[model samples]
Target: MDSHKILSLLGLALRGNHLAVGEEPVEAAARAKDARLLLLASDAADNTRRRTVHFSEAGQCLWLRLPFTKAELGRAVGRTSAALVAVTDIGLANAVANRLAQLDEDQYGEAAERLALKAKRAAERQSELRAHEKNVRTGKYRPKPRRTPEDSSPQVEKSPPDRRPRNQNRSRPRRGSPTRSPHPYAHSRPVKKGKGSFRKRED
Candidate 1:
């Protein structure tokens, strides 16, 4: 089908059901899984192209690679760098499928074949990525063994002990008793002298 016809059909389909449009191929691919048809530009990136093709093949959805420029594709779908567009309706679904089938029989056959090949390659790449991710998650990719507490203990030399007593004078004074004097005069009282009573009568 012509690009204008495809665009009109897509608009009708979008009007009939909820449609999700994306500027990136990955988002478009995700939406395409539940969509009746997916639309992409001819100038999409290798990754985007592969993803779009994969979405179409894996989901059994009709796909169209428009010959318009990125800007034109964006204008057609009302976004910039629009790599993917989804149409979700039974009527539009059947129309897009029929249109794409007719295009595949005509001038678009070579492009469709190339998309199929790219989709196959993308599928293989996805499988490899998943395998690598699983290995990493399961710790199969790591080679070094983890360290344990036994591997980190330190070795120390033994030392000899001293024999000296801890306290030389261990006796403790009673709570109410007088403390022992350190000198002879520490507790002594002063002596006093007085004259006899007969000496006082002379005054």
Candidate 2:
């Protein structure tokens, strides 16, 4: 159950085309009936682990968490990096699982416990907020009303139109059109000398 042996078996599985590497392939393999086991890296992202676990459980496949980092697992199978790998061959799956079980305690249990604790705290916070909302609705808690600046200021009552501007010289700039005086030549008809209004007098 040495780590080296486990890695060698994974490489063999990959070479024989019985291994599914990377996220999508692992998820697909887990969902397929032929998949026998899913191997997840210890440092695999929370989201990746969650997805693979969900799919594996749904497909009723076994999932084993390895102690290696993504790079180590990927390198074992000639990959750049990998979060998951699925074994499609039953014999290889059992061998890998048994090997893993022999050497170490549950490598994944601590992470799972942390996730569960976080979920519990979040649920408790949400429940408290819901209870507070229910109390507000039932009139058990009354929040104080906030006062705005306008509410606090006094009204001036608009003093008597400013007393007609004291001396009337500047009285609202005169509202109506003022009367226009007549033109100087308004009394006389236009001279009828010609249709043209003005012409030189005959000599």
Q: lDDT per residue, candidate 1, 1-203, as tens digits?
A: 36567666766655665455774543554445665556777777888777777777776665667666667766665666576776654345455545555655675554445545555675698899999999999989975798788677775666877666756444777588887678969677665567444556564
lDDT by residue for model 2 over 1-203, one digit each (tens)?
A: 38999999999999899998887777777666767778889898889878887978876776777889999998999989988988887667766765666675475444334434544675698899999999999999999899899888996787665655466856454669674446767777876655784676999
* Local distance difference test, candidate 2: 0.78
Cα-based lDDT at residue 11, candidate 1: 62
Leading candidate by lDDT = 2
Q: Which lDDT value does model 1 have at 82?
A: 70
lDDT for residue 53 in candidate 1, whole number 0-100: 73
Q: List the candidates' TM-scores in order.
A: 0.41, 0.51
The window of 10 residues in a row where model 2 has the poorest summed lDDT is 108-117
Model 1: residues >4 Å from true position, as ranges?
A: 23-33, 97-104, 107-203
